[model samples]
Target chain A: MKKINFSAGPAILPASVLTQAAAAVENLDGSGLSILEISHRSDAFDAVLVEAEQLVRELLNVGDEYGVLFLSGGASTQFFFTAMNLLNPEETAGYLDTGSWSAKAIKEAKNFGKVNIIASSKESNYDHIPRGYTVPDGLKYVHLTSNNTIFGTQFKEWPETDAPLVADMSSDIFSRRIPLEKFGIIYAGAQKNLGPAGATLVIVRKDLLGKVNRTLPSMLDYRVHIDGGSTYNTPPVYPIYVMMLTLRWIKAQGGLEGMEKHNERKAKLLYEEIDRNPKFRGTVADDFSRSQMNVTFVCTDEADTAAFQAAAEAAGCDGITGHRSVGGFRASIYNSMPYEGVETLVRVMREFE
Target chain B: MKKINFSAGPAILPASVLTQAAAAVENLDGSGLSILEISHRSDAFDAVLVEAEQLVRELLNVGDEYGVLFLSGGASTQFFFTAMNLLNPEETAGYLDTGSWSAKAIKEAKNFGKVNIIASSKESNYDHIPRGYTVPDGLKYVHLTSNNTIFGTQFKEWPETDAPLVADMSSDIFSRRIPLEKFGIIYAGAQKNLGPAGATLVIVRKDLLGKVNRTLPSMLDYRVHIDGGSTYNTPPVYPIYVMMLTLRWIKAQGGLEGMEKHNERKAKLLYEEIDRNPKFRGTVADDFSRSQMNVTFVCTDEADTAAFQAAAEAAGCDGITGHRSVGGFRASIYNSMPYEGVETLVRVMREFE
Candidate 1:
């Protein structure tokens, strides 16, 4: 059966991207060499890297003042690298821990320097994003996850703070419009919205560097990657190439503006099916919930949630399984997810009812 | 038109593994979901994780006393994390700087504690692995890279050190029989020798845990990964799955002993071609050179090299383009490189002569 997929990340890539990626895997650029076969430093792969970074800058409205990087290790590596780069020895960095990922990032930051939990919603089991976190003036940088992919919440409006802002936009990047100038840095793992799990995408304002007190390793040195174009060392080549293909797909789908509308509509349709149907209910509080991405909801009977999932699968919708940490169903509507896929999911929900 | 791949990393994977990976990408486990669609926490992926970990132990001849971890970041992250976990803030550790990767590891170590380069080949520009370096007494551990991918060198044997030893076997893990008992730890990024770049294999002796001065991030802490089963967070799932398939392929090729024979023959065939044919000469010393993988050689006539590369490509020997830093040809004859491929290369070499 043709499946409508809702995987959170490494989720759904556009057919064109997949076709291009598959062909590139065998023979990239008609060079008789697989994309995996080319050297990272070769002009062949250099074009891939330059164009990939250029796409990130163009799609996100980032300026040349920002250094866009693609490096190995996922955003999980960034959780610590960002901390090491930004946090001075004596100063404490502030973190707003909204869910599992932000919590991971905050945990990594504590190892480098003094870490202050500005605010967190884990007390409420991450049902909502923290509202009243105070970003201290003397803090090194305030780290926040723009969207909680697991907990089904988002910071609809970002906190306006004097401290340099570092956002882990792993799950929410390219899903909407944002003022790129406000943040000192933004990092994401490409698996969610961009491509695969091997490479991490980092965009840092060039000015925020050089203040780090700790001796950074070449791997941890954002400056090294910025200078070497994220290929200072051999990077995960195939992953970055897929990311380029993904970006191409996103652009062909009408770029960032088109993606926002697509994701918003997919998420809304799925959530509407859940909320309006008697058999199911939405998980998060309505006003604070997210739309340009994941939709989490549950069936009336927890046991029957499995039945709902089975029905959805039988009806050709896939990957609607919710996180075990937060039960029920989660439909992750990333950039490549067609509205028709969401409609199929909605129809699955009605059939289950 | 067949292609013979020798790309340094993201290198050649077994044909069976690629076929399986392609099918898995389309439909994982008959669940009608792509392997990319499933959560790392799902029972299906968890099975893959367990199998990958188990295969590491089986292949390495590591007993139950050791902890095997599959992490997302490359060996670069583990370089510091290893130092962070093993070194106390007040103490000094020993490092043997052979080539590029070891230098990076040494830099990451300085962030945690004092580091002494017990020996270095920097004066030689890393053309060889350093010799005559004895382990310093009272040092936390001795660190070395078993093989240098870029420089095309490998350590033939390790030091009989009183201090515990740690090796970044990133480019040469599983290439031959390792003295598993000699080192407290051995880590490799799974690209050249293992599988792909995203997943890192860290095998650590259990007694060396919990010695660092600072608090640990769950991801950075070796103990955390051990305790949480390396599923500490959403891992690089697809990469891990690919590694699992590669391991299976390795076993099917008669495990490490078979792999050793296969690699030895391939390297011998290529090295024989480079040595006898006046056209080509090896970069590393014959006695201490890598026998199992990464054979880099130069042609006597510079003008003949590009023409030779084109001729080799037409003859189905590809990815033979040498690294830019070390110009000429580098054939990374890792385990997946079929004997037939090497035979074809040898035939081409004979024609060159």
Candidate 2:
């Protein structure tokens, strides 16, 4: 049976991409060498790095002022790296504590400089995006988790701020179109909508670097990677190659606009079933703030939760269980989750009801 | 024609491992989902992580006193991380300047603490490992690059020092056994003898941590990864899986002892040919210091270099070209490069002569 994977991360990639990647693993483009054995400095891998960067730019409409870097150590590393490069000891950066990821980012940023919490929805268990928070001037940058995978809340609108906006878009990077000009830095782990778990996609405004007074580690510094073209050392070659394949798949899907429509349709189908089915109810406090990527919901009667889970598993639905902290269900309909997969889940919910 | 790959770091892996890894990329052990799509927290992946750690402990004879961690950002990140976690700003560490990599490691260590160059071969262009340096008491640790990939030299004997030995064993780990008791920490990027380019294998003594006074970034701090079981933040999933597969292959081939004998035989075959063929001459000054993993040599006549390269290419021998700095040839016959592959390279060298 073909399992419907709703894994929050290290999530579903396009089937075609997986097939091609598998083939490349054995013999890359009939070059008689496995992709795993290729050197990062070789012309073949240089092409991969260049094409991946170009695809990111074309798909995201990234400007020339920004440098697209495919780096190792996921978004978790970027949490502190962003601050380390841009935030000085005397400067302060504003962060919105919307969910667990944002909170962790705040914790790391505080190590480098002063981190001011602009607003927080933590009191409500991060059930919605915090609103009406005044953005203070003189901040180094305003940071936020654009999409929270844990609580299933996403920022529907940009927070009004003059400081360069830094966002961790790990779960929903390619799912929708964004205002590229508004972001000074946008970093995402490749597992969610991109490709796999090893590579991190970082888009940074080149002008935003070199202001910090502290000495930066070569690997941690964005300038070093940008200058080296993301090959300062041996990069995650396999992951970057897989990402390139995923990017090609995205381009075939008519770029981000097509992905937005596809993802929105899937989210609408699943959310409607959650609302209509008597056994279920959505978890987020506000419908407007609910994530279009990870749709979290729960059974109205706690007893039905276990029954529904068993049925879903039997029906070949995998990874629908919510995080341990949330304890319900999270159907992560990322860019590659076909509409039919969501339809299958809705059918299961309807049957349970 | 199947090429004999000798690329250094991001080098060749066992053929069977490549086939199995390729199969897993599409569907991991009939799980009905691609390995690239599985969650790291899933039981399937948990088994992989556990087994990989066990293999390391068994093969390396790692005791419970140390932590076996799989991290991201490669060994380049560890150049600074080791110093940040072990060396304080006021303390000093000894570093043996052997090759380009060791030079870089020394440069990064200088950022965190006082560095003493105990011995250096930089004046000799790193053609040999410096020796006879007396170790001073009270130094934090003595750092060395076990195998100098760029210059084709290796340390045959460890220095006498009370301080813990921190080795950057990026090029030759898993190819041979070592006295694990002498080293406080051993880190290697999984691009050479291990697996691919993303995951970094770090074995650190538990007591060595928490000695540094500086507040560490969670990502750079080894303790964070150790405590998190190396899943601190979505580890390079595919890379770790590939490494696990490679580890399994290593075990099947008689563990470290079997690997050492196999590697030694391959090195001997190629080195014997290089010494016999009047067209070639070994680059390392000391015969005992010549690396068994990477056999570097040059054409006796400079003009014959391009001719040998063309002949090697025509015969389907890949990655034999040496580093541009050295400007000769580097036949990196890592553990995975079968005896037959080295035989083919030897044939090419003989034909060139």
Using DockQ as the measure, the top candidate is 2
- The 10 consecutive residues of candidate 1 chain B with the worst lDDT sum are B283-292
Tell me the docking grade of candidate 2: high
> For model 2, what is the error of residue B6's alpha carbon versus the real structure, in angstroms, after optimal superposition?
0.7
Residues A1-353, candidate 2: write the lDDT tens digits.
77999999999999999999999999999999999998899889999988999999999999899999999899999999999999999899999999999999999999999999999999999999988889999999999999999999999999898899999999999889999999999999999999999999999999999999999989889999999999999999999999999999999999999999998899999988888888999999998889999999998999888899999998889999998878899989999999899888888888888
Model 1 over residues A1-353: C-alpha lDDT tens digits?
65776877657766566666666655677776556445666688889888998899889989988999987666787898888888876879888888899888887887788888888888777888767565777887889999888878888877768887899998888888887878889999887888866677899998889888767766678898888888776677777888888888888778888888887777777777777899998777655645457788888888797678788878877778888888898888888788888888888778778
- Runs of candidate 2 with Cα error greater than 4 angstroms are none
Question: Looking at candidate 1, what is the lDDT of residue A328?
Answer: 90
Cα lDDT of model 2 by residue, B21-112, tens digit: 99999999999999899999989999999999999999999999999999988889989999999998999999999999999999999999
Note the DockQ of each predicted structure: 0.41, 0.90
List candidate 1 stretches off by more than 4 Å: A89-94, A112-124, A130-140, A300-306, B121-136, B288-290, B300-310, B321-327
